[model samples]
Target: MNENKKTLGELLNASYSAFGYAIGFSCLVNLLMLTAPIYMLQVFDRVLPSQSSDTLVYLTIIAILAIIVYGILDIARAQVLTRVSWWIDNKLSPIALAKSLDHTLLGGSYAAQSLADITTLRQFLSSPSIYAFFDAPWIIIFLIVIFLLSFPLGIIATLGAIVLLSLAILNEKVSRKPLEQANTLHMNNQESISNSIRQAECIQAMGMMSPIVSKWLHNNEAVLAMQCTASDRSGIVLSFSKSIRLILQILILGVGAYYVINGELTSGAMLAASIIMGRALAPAEQAIGAWKQAINALQAYRRLQHYLSQPETRPPEILLPKPQGRIDVNNLLYIPAGAKKPVIQGVQFTLMPGESLGIIGPSGSGKSTLARLLVGIWPPTNGTVRLDGANIYTWNRQDIGNHVGYLPQDTLLFKGSVKENIARMDKIEDAKIISAAQFVGVHDMILHLSHGYDTDTSRYHLSGGQAQRIALARAFYGSPALVVLDEPESNLDQEGLAALELIYKNAQKSGITIIVVSQRPMLMKHCNKVLVMRDGHMERFGLYAEIIR
Candidate 1:
């Protein structure tokens, strides 16, 4: 698993050759930028003085050709960056998605931010903003050319470059904090809105929408204020830099005119020197213009680096035989990441092959947490949960996935056909889907839908009871050896309850071990053993009749 861990920095390092090509192209583009000034010099100094139309025409032709080549090279540079951006996205998106899922499963928020960061990074990579930095270093070439034209002009141009560079630095320092703050607030606001949307039915039914909207508006105002602060600061710097560049260009023209009058520089040289000075300072001004994007991209890059640096959570792939129905929990404890108290602690139990156990507990007594542990969804902080004598959390999912079934409390049905969801999103034989559906007695219910087994879950809305039945079929898919069902009967009706009993009988007949987190009497009658829990500790564990007596 470690061998598969790849970082954004490492991926960029691998693309160094592509960047090198872009830099090489930038060099040629910057060199070709001198075409206009050189052409001006030749036309004004040599062509006019010599009174030669041929010389002017030939100069024009050469300048046009140089500009064409410069345009082609510039396009090539952008193309290279675009391709590199795609390559990085292709490699890092899956890793980002996996990490995002792991982070969410571990009870963290901001899962969407990882993908958003990738978009920001990719946009900056293929944007004109990045090219500004590449073009920045070549300003020295323009300054040198200015010096060769006139020493005084060269000094002035150099000072102008230094001043613009300072403003660019100042822009970064001033606007970075507010921009970063605004970005953080924006992400929070997005998460808030997403949560509200997900619970829109509840909010509307309970008259909670007004309060939720008010709170959202309040948070959004803060985000806007921070963004305004950043923009005002950047605007000031950018505007000042633009003004300074214009003033310098005018100053150069005035100085060149004076020098030309004094015969210290020729007319062509004076004109060329002013143009070169403007070219020398253009990069710094452009950098100021795009400073905000640069800072955002830098922040995104850093976040991705940290996100990718996390240790791989997936177990290494190994060929292991299918697990029997045995489970062993040895002194297991689990404390959430930022919590002081454990959700489930000192939990120890064992179930022999094909034995069914029912977990009973109050609302906050960690029954769901224990069910999660049994299915390897959450790792224990201390001790281990072993299936077939191997730690369940460390068992390679690819090897053990087919042998286990889990129905989470939420009972989510992914967007797919009824048959596809029953098959756990795997495209498999229709016989397996039908058999799994039949095991849970949902096969007839599925056929009554608009498209029978092929109905799209996204477009068709199932009633709560119907969805639960379908989810039950999914849990019973493939005749798994171990099945953990959390609050499985919450949405069931009388018929559904009868189906649940049939499922238990079918599971027992097939020798599948069941761990159900429920307290209902109907479900309890089918369990051989019952484990009672309260306050993160086990209250009792024995045969169902023994516990009841």
Candidate 2:
């Protein structure tokens, strides 16, 4: 909401302009608060004493108009609060989503919790409970009005308001920590369930479904216990606040009657004092009951603030002009996630356009790690991976992606059509999709499916080799300047192997740079050069024929 700065408060305050209007409306509504008691007083004192029918008629009509206006103002303020909630949803949800995405990329679960926090804040803003706090300050105004009517009445109302205020404060103190603890337990419970669902297939394969379910239930029960404890305490506080408010109203009425009997007050004044005293305590009682929601909203606001305090990630910068597919890796090293030792240690290589390189290494030799580094998936620990003399890591990633193709060892596909999968979910152009599929020799395989290119891949199961080839088509969807494939033929049969060779032959002729990592020596035969890695260190780098010799 601020041009030179941004914070959760600023974004939330952007909606308070509506509250500004609502507060102005609230002033009129509070003035209208005088309607009921004053209406009763006029009927009792003025109409009965004067006994003029016309005076009675005029007063009744005027009171009706005041009540109607009060109703309208109250409705307008509620609508304004509703609009404030809408503003928060529309404005903050996207920012929260982006921040959540950053967390997801850094190995955190998808930012569902962050979005949930925003939703909690939005609901609190829109709920009627929020109006309790908004109306709270007016309690003093009503007490002051009562003071003007009679000093004794004012003193009684003041003591009642103080008692209600004290109860509200006590409610906050008693409930705050338990509510926060319940919320934390609830989050942990949800996360445990999410983990079970995400890895359900593994659990099923391992025959551990029952145990996982029992574990989830056990965690959830803990949350329920915490919630029950919090609810019990809050319920007691709410009951006490309500009882005190009703008792105070009766006490004010008794005092007002006593004053009237002593010739210090009139009958209407006695009734009005009781009316205003009830009105004065109503907001505090409401506030005491609404403290739970206030605590929840406050916690949510703090979480959002903590999320925003993390380093912000901005959109990609300018994309470099299309380059000639040259890759420069200088003193590259990488320490993988949750590991202390570097996975690729001081390994560097460069491949010119139209050249093909093969990386052959035993298991745990960092071949896949190097492939990942070359494609800009992981930043190197020590040096740079430059594509066309600019660091690809800092490039406008989506634009640079147009010229880069990558096939990680483990393939992935979202739920979509076969054509969509082949095109990486881009606009499905028939020729492009089929050409990529044909290059990987999955064209005929896809056509044989129940709906061919339009088939929903989620409902359609592909064998290991079939899935691998389809993923290959995806990596080749666009005309990429650099192609890095890790274990491309891991699941492929003899026919699949030939198709991969043809794909590489095409890349060799088209001046596209290629890097392939494989365990099979047959797959590395066509490479003009070879690199051998062992235990994160490059053992050999030279012409393929010479290295073999």
Candidate 3:
């Protein structure tokens, strides 16, 4: 297990210092924003009336310098946010991908959604919607300046702020449900499409394309409707907020004029007040406009939190000697995560090194499930599986991975060179890969490939038998002490079956413990012990001759 696995919140919390720097930059940028209005004030009150070119030139140079500094700080603020986004992505993407793989093994759907959530958060951090928040707190600074210029004008700006803030709240209230619903539906649709693509052969052969497309469109239509509802409502609120800000600007200027008429305010102050009022209301207006994005990011963060909440409890690896294939099971029972009944129950068995066990059963007899438990892919609901006197489930897999070989019922080969696949993606020498291939009788078949041992599985298509053989070779790659093969001969011809028998002979000679889940006569003949399963129960266990009799 990775000791550095962090929950999403912790990862985000770790980046708080980066965000603090961004905020500091934003602070400087916002303070520099005062340069524009103040320049207008000085030009109106001092330069114009002084009728002196020296004063005008000096003010212009000062204003230009201030604006230049403001621009640099603003760019720096955005750069900080960008780096923070990358930093968080660098830390969290690997964890999300690892967790997604774990989730897939646990039969979870939409495993890629965790990665997508990280992407959403990364984009949100780099987006302007976030900067609106960083600048929001400075709204009061502009408001207080407005008050100093004219009290009545300040009151109007404050009212405008209240109205726009109210609209922001309204935007959230009305749009949250639809946005959340739309996101859920969208994710489900993506999962369905991805699954359908993987099974395209079956779907196309059975003429399921039309119905599948229609159902997909129906789901998409529902998602679109929800998104439209949210967007329409958000648009209305955003438009309203903008209109209010505009009206506030005009009202500030009008009230400032009235005060100027009474000698309570100067003309320079009147124009400055209008500009300041707009500045005060800008953040609220921008927030209302980006409210939908903000909501999406919040929801994405929450989803990431939920998925990453699982603790990595795999114990630290201890320097233990390699397992020698001795096996034990006591009252082993397993029920899947959300199931009412156990898939396998009250089953117990043991095998010594160099022994072989054959598990035979009907279609729904849980043979495959048992094989998974034996290999420690799934933890038992009750009891334990011990290999060489250590709990197989608790053993650090990395420490003993080479000693345990598993060939799942549904064989899958990764998109890599033939040698890489045989070596389990480990950086091993060609001699070892050739040995595994030769041991499993796949060496000749692999040499016949276009690139021999270097063929990429993705580019060079293979028949079902070919793929299964490659997976078999992988299982035997390291000369594992315990090799569990589920239906190993299902896709093999007579030649392949003969090869499998030869491998079994090789295993016997090498002192490897073997478990085969099959009723195929060619495979069953090689098993000294047979366990018969029916509806997840061990109905018979003894010598092969007695079980067959």
Candidate 4:
């Protein structure tokens, strides 16, 4: 708890009124819980001894009304708890999703598990077993009434409570370690299964399914063994608690009978004492029975608290004006998410608005890193990449993305119509979509499809070259001021290459800046300047004619 920066209790306290109301309902319900034994006591002691039909009728009527009100209170409490859980879910679901995505982008664990944790907490809130925790304090309340009957009875009930409570604590201590181990084992197995499914094609081609299955089973068996250990340990305590409760309850009657024979208690008082003692011990017994679930709930709560403690990435302080495609890098450097040394070090360059630069490098020469930095996909390790005089990383990414275009080596389309993909899923414009497609020479190919622009392109059903052309069309959409294409023609054929050249001519005429990262020099013919990189540093940067010479 000292190590935790935020806690489940704090999150619950944020919804103070809802929790307060639920607790209020619990108090009311527990107060009403006293109704049953009291009603039985009155019938056995007062009404029957009085021998008046009217007295019996009146007492019975009052008891029935009290029981009805008790039922109502229980129902109301359940509804309140359910709503509180709903309010929590509605409030935290979106925030958790956004936080999870941001963390993932920064190389943190996936937050989807937090959603599952929240559901587990919601179940804990609504489960009938949960009411035991709330009712626990009322054991003293019940014991006080027992004391009013006889000192001996009060002592017996107190001892019973202590014993049951001890069993609950024992249950927790016995199961905690194994339960924690089981949870860890479960997570490892889940990750293994997810990885196997994701790489199923590779596994199939390599015929490694049998070996993977054996590894998965080994992980699963460890989890199962821990689960069995926890269950066995908790089962012993749970069974012992139930046994003690029954024995003490039955002995309460015997003790009460002994007192009754000595005129210390009445027959009615003896029966009432036994019933009240069971009522008091029932809660602890229920808790003992569910100790394993309680441990899981505790783990889930801590996981969520740790996740919530992580600071969220803030949005831009204020929206900035649109930037022209003038890029300036000063002593720029980059290191991957988890690495010891920089991948690009002390590299610097500048490109004026409307300038076209071609980036050529050997494999692992940091060309892709340079392109990503220029587009503000990531922040630099040191120094900065500025666009139009302000640091590009300081600007709002969503706002700045409006003016940037990129074609990554890997092109992925969402489950949407061709027009939507071209428009980057923003509001559709017929002219912009058609013009971009025509710019990439995919317009005729699109029209030939059955649904033309409205076709659902979930699977990239077209040929590889055709898919690359569509991706190129997307990059050219809206005539973004700066276009960065990282190996854009890797999958394009001669016709697609011609379309690429046409886009360059058209973009050059329109004065849009372009940066193309490629290994092959086929498209360098269209570049006026070239930058060469070798071993994470700039090797040469000059006019195309000079560099070629």
Give the TM-score of each candidate. 0.95, 0.88, 0.94, 0.88
Count of steric clashes across candidates, in order: 0, 0, 0, 0
The best candidate by lDDT is: 1
lDDT of 4 by residue, 476-526 (tens): 898788899999888788888888898888778877888899997667778
Q: Give the Å error, residue 96, model 2.
A: 2.8
lDDT per residue as tens, model 2, 183-270 = 9988888888887888888999999999988987888788788778778888998898888777877888888888888989888978
> TM-score of model 2 relative to the true fold?
0.88
Best by TM-score: 1
Off by over 4 Å in 3: 1-10, 260-263, 312-319
Better of 1 and 3 by TM-score: 1
- Report, for every candidate in turn, its global Cα lDDT versus the true structure: 0.88, 0.83, 0.87, 0.82
- In model 1, the Cα lDDT at residue 46 comes to 98
Clashes of 3: 0
Name the lDDT of candidate 3.
0.87
Q: Candidate 1 versus the native: TM-score?
A: 0.95
lDDT at residue 68 of model 3 (Cα atoms): 96
Q: How many residue pairs clash in model 4?
A: 0
Give the alpha carbon lDDT tens digit for every residue of 1-549 in model 3: 334434555776878988999999988898888888898898888888889899889989998999999999889888889888988888888877876776687787756898888788889999988988998998888889888877888889888888988998899999999999999999999999988999999998999999999999999999999999999999988888888878887888888888889998888989988888787788888888888888888998888776677655344556578888999999999999999998999999899999999999898899999999998887788999989988887777676777899999989899899899999999868888898899889999998999998999999998889999999999988888899999999789888989999988888888999999996544677787999999999999998888776
Prediction 3 TM-score vs. true = 0.94
